[model samples]
Target: MTEQRQDPILIVGGGMAGALLALLLRHHGASAVTLVESHPLTLPDEPPLTPSFDARSTALSAGTLSVLDELGLAEAIREHAAAIDTVHVSRRSRLGITRLRASEEGVPALGAVVENRWLGFVLLRALYADAAIQVLAPERLSAIRRLADGYEATLESGRTLTTPLLIAADGAKSRTREWLGVSARDSDTGHDAMIANLSLASDHQGIAYERFLNDGPLALLPLPDRRFGLVWTGPRDQVDAWMEMESGALLKQLQQQCPAEAPRITGIGERQRYPLILTHACAQAVPFGVVVGNAAHTLHPVAGQGFNLTVRDLVQLACTVGGASAPGKLSLLQQYVQRREQDQALISQASRWVPEMFRVQQPLFAHSRQLGLVAMDILPGLRQGFARRAMGL
Candidate 1:
């Protein structure tokens, strides 16, 4: 096949991570970036008849907020997001709150809770608004080949293009990663997470709660209205039962499971379920490519850190490539991997271990878990340090 040369960086997957990275690169004066998305660009004409819901919602840490501010997407997000001023963490059977207060961290808000779709819309808006960026939606990648100086990709529509760099943000099942021969290990947690939207009787008051039950972690995140985003993890059979319940019954069950003094579930919205899986790529960077977002690491949604971690990957990559004359150079890619290797390892390890900490039936293990929470609460310096590290500050 004849080779078709291109002048811009090529990004596969127009999801949050890819769109954000494209915007960041454009902001840093990297022109001619092209994003290819398998999904169509137009928004669905009809909203959910019951309640609008997204499978995921991201908790933007303070440092993440700063990064978004630099990218000019912060204001757009703030305009649509719910500011979480407090995080209340506790055991399901216990009555005491373990962590609280955003003020203690010297930030106006601990984080912002925004629907995954809203974030995507904002990024798409920014991407389309930029004249230097080109987006191809409803397009699929068929194959990729490494060239002498760059890479060449073929679209399902029989179009071929070449660029210096190929970014794989397609997701955990990334085709680019597979084509490039990157290996990843997958772990099945034998659990599933059910996410939905519900309107509570009482206002959430911008509070985010993580209730650790014997089954798994249950999160209720405040949304724009009196509604809250719910992420509940448990055994597959149990989650299947919950998903099968009627709207009213499901709401009642949720209210009982959650510790907040919320009234009966007034309304229930769209509900969806996904199997929980933890996956980590053997390597995050290659000679002419790198994988970000779910493609790089897929974590349990218990901590709401999956997307946030992916965004952090983009931030680190941008910082590494900003000053380079050739961003796709082997030396630059190696440096990017070195700079982000530790942080990625730390997050992956911590995410894998934290859930295990709560699985212990022994008294000593339970006591240690409680003590760890207490330490995180009382030690302002430690909490602040964690917050900073998460934000990639």
Candidate 2:
């Protein structure tokens, strides 16, 4: 029998964030990393509605691309990536249209969008190829017992692993964070997001759209092949009716909410429903456990900032853990919290308001914001700052 290890660093998820963390740690020369996930690890060429990876797409900020490049994982998935050269923002029934071009920002591109499944495949490939990492899936973290110097994790399959540190990358409803008794403040945005890969009549031309309606902001992000990844965030109760509507009728509703010149939704992939909620964990780390990714802070996809924020947390955590002799040390955890507190607070604040800035219902308030949008277009410095911040600067 193989010897049972007591000090391997155990990561408790195998999603993008978790897998990326293991790879980052290995790149930093940290070893003996083990990742456990409740979902299946093997993603078929046609992925299903799995927890880790599916057809849902994400817009990776330019800064995130740089991180992926630095970690040597970008090229592997470049073929599946589509650049965003322009962003067009407008409110329904308003003449004020704001455009931010990558050329104005002095960057190669604002960002890129990639299907989550492709990202999952790429991360999994890199993870499996690394000898220092052990990938475990179809297994779930059920319980944890924190020790003075380490912690022991019990899986649903009765397998046990003890490690000096534990990372909770287990999505929003993380059992690991609950095991550590971490409390969070979660605010439901009173909205539900209907996401799918949508084929449009007009090509995106590497352009993204943020069209503000009476209800909420609707983002049409560019995907390959004249398709756009749709994030139709609507009222919670009405989303079910919208999802069930015939394609033509639903496309009509979508077109009504977008600009008069917007593309028509021709076809769509499987629609996945997600309740938009913003979460902030009061405690990020304990003696031998730490939370990262959506588990640490789940944000609204208003600005598509959820993954970007999580990536930063993962990168910083990996670097901090790499330099520390003890990954579970309180000093290291405290430093991580202190370093991230400001950015977390700032981004959370900005995300909350950015969505509201587009609500065009009341005539007076709508006009005020329309004027604000016009100002954003006219002021180069202000627009550049907003663009830079949105690109995860």
The candidate that achieves the highest lDDT relative to the unseen native structure:
2
Q: Rate residue 46 of model 2 by lDDT.
A: 44
lDDT of 2 at 140: 87
The sequence of per-residue lDDT tens digits that candidate 2 reaches over residues 16-111 is: 789889988877657679999887787446442457587688999998988899988888767888999998998877778889999999999998
Candidate 1 overall Cα lDDT vs. reference?
0.78
As for candidate 2, its clashing pairs are: none
Per-residue CA lDDT of candidate 1, range 1-393, in tens?
A: 994434788899887788888988877667578899887765443211111124567777776787888878899889878998877777766534555567776778878888877777777777878898888877988988889877899999999988788898888888888887898888999999998887877778888888888888888888887878888899999999998998877777777888755334688778888888887888777877888888889988866777777777787787777545677887888887888777778888877777777767688878777777778778878767766665445
Model 2 segments more than 4 A misplaced: 1-6, 43-49
lDDT value for candidate 2? 0.83
Clashing pairs in 1: none
338 Cα displacement, candidate 1 (Å)? 1.1
Q: What is the TM-score of each candidate against the true structure?
A: 0.92, 0.94
Count of backbone clashes, every candidate in sequence: 0, 0
lDDT of 1 at 370: 77
